[model samples]
Target: MITLINNPVQLKRELLKVVQKELKDEELKVAKSDWHSRRKPIGCGLTIHPGIGCPMQCSYCYIYDMGFSVHATPYSLSGLQLVAALLFNKYFYPTRWGTYLAFGSVTEPFLPNILPKTLEYLKAIVEYLGNPCQVSTKMVINDENVDKLARVGGSKLSILVTVTSLSQYVYLERRAPHPLKRLELVSKLRRKGFKPFIFIRPLLPGLRAEEVDEIVEQAKASGAYGIVVGNLRLSPNIVKRLISEGIDVTKYLRVDLGKLKSGFVDVRVDGDTQTLIRERALSKGLIFLRRACCANTVSQLLSGYNDVACPSLCFLNEKVCEKSCPSQCKVKAGGEPKQFNFHEVIREVLGFDEYEVEVEGHTMYIKLKKPLRDEKSASFALSYLFRRRIRFIYE
Candidate 1:
């Protein structure tokens, strides 16, 4: 082993040989369970990862643990394979109401090498599925691909531009474009008539009230249609990375070192700060969102909602009841709401083995590993299972 390490050229050759072999061994396939109850303010239904790992290497990104950090092994689906997988899925919705496709969840959809393929994949979705799609990226946008994206996305394309921090961009997003440049790109997309939303994700825990306001104002000034703020979801590896970069993880957020679960070090910002952020956005006339995804924001932007409060209406608004808001607003409890027995009925009818159900008052957020074979069938099953009229968001 020592000799192999000493001979750098030989080591490189051997590693290349193994990597090529693994790539060849990989099979053409798509994700089986595309639906998820993710933490982002984007819908987690029918997520597509055109490529397997992200080269950007954001220190805090969860994809590091989701099978993308291993430099030796690369994974991705080909255009033909992606189209085939999507077409073969029986659970996909035929119309826009039931089907909202999201891209770039696990991998950067516009990585330099994979950008062309990503465009191809989007075009295929347009031709075959015709489902509304959403994408968030930190890559530098160019005229060539931007035009292609417009063609593929058409009127149903929702864009999320993630800018965690203008100050911390150098440290956190080492490989991605500058935060200000990303804002410029957002403005450009807005000029193109795309509904681009700003995502201040992993909202560095201890951000000052003024700092939050600044981000909101800047995004709004940049022509962002809406803004979504998210807290950092930290894992042990992520914490270690931050620490190595001299980031005071504790100062940014609270970390329960003893309560680590699923390889993640639990860290979260206080609710008061999040509330303050929302208030600031509302005061600035910007569309603020809480725990909602890009799809929800786009729905609110395109089709106005009723029965929603002035400040909170623009945020946390869902396009249910024929793209209308709910009759009344109800507060939801945090930290994964409990699932009731009605979920069992959904499971039995939809044939889902793995699922999560979050019930907030009368509203139920159900996340299925695999999409339902038929949206109407699932709705019918829910209607049959529960006599009460429960608002449900199927992810």
Candidate 2:
């Protein structure tokens, strides 16, 4: 029997029927939160964690403070599995959207023990998905892995190497590679035709103007394509750790000590200080990236992918890009209310290659040439298309 849905109310009526039927045959388990959703903060659509924790243990690292893991441990999918998960993820629409997949959000991708497998996973991602990817790391990049990394990044990979202060690397980074070694790796990657950017994160709050100038100059000399500067972000646990270690980062940031026990605080680098760094970067002929764009925008722009989902470094702060005011943003669904394209929405959300939308009298009808995966998916598609809670007519 073929049932036709006449109006939006009819669609809404069948919503829960489809949902209950969809779940009837499946054994429900507590859903594991997908790591794919972690990409919004840094403007990428997908984030792959090669491991659960980082051995580097940089003092300001939020992952450590959050108790995920202080040492690196493998927690990633095989390359092919990662490709499948990405392709099937509802948020990904490779045909019409430019999405970036970032490696190393919760863990370091190229940590010593996991480097070989990480490289293999990178190769697989490039070979299979070919999506734009980025890798942010503090580990030493060996001479051997440079070409492979470049190949994996394809035209869209941006490798951001973190080097805050060479003089303080020993104390700050602890187990990570020496600052010079990491800088040398950046130079090599640049020489090999890969886009390498410098991340002077947490910008080591009390450095002199000359010290900042020296770091930027060195990065430029190393063939860095751009420079990303960030200020120290602190959590209550992290603040305690710093204090216990006899490091006082408070004077370098605009912080209210009274708020210390309350919750996490952003010990922001002041506007004047940030501007000074930005000016220095521009003066040295490097692009000064602000917020969480984190030098990824440079590559994205050069490659003509301007649809950054969330244009700030919200990821680093354990937050997602809110995507507020998504006016001209194509990657985000549901744009200007007047410019609604229902067919496009159906194609994107339902994974339909072919469909026809017909109008009869006052009602719009969608005909699916092929059956959807399930009734629930039809309702899901409807909700996304209307940019609100709606259902679908399932036959």
Best by lDDT: 2
Model 1 stretches with alpha carbons more than 4 Å out: 1-43, 70-80, 251-254, 258-261, 265-270, 292-395
Model 2 spans with C-alpha error above 4 angstroms:
1-34, 37-45, 244-246, 254-263, 292-294, 303-343, 346-395
Tens-digit lDDT string for candidate 2 (83-155): 4444434444221122456777678888877776677767766654444567888887667777667666564
Residue 367 shift from truth in candidate 2, angstroms: 21
Best by TM-score: 2
Kindly give the stretch of ten consecutive residues in candidate 2 with the minimal lDDT sum: 24-33
TM-scores across all candidates?
0.66, 0.68
Compute the lDDT of residue 88 as modeled in candidate 1.
35
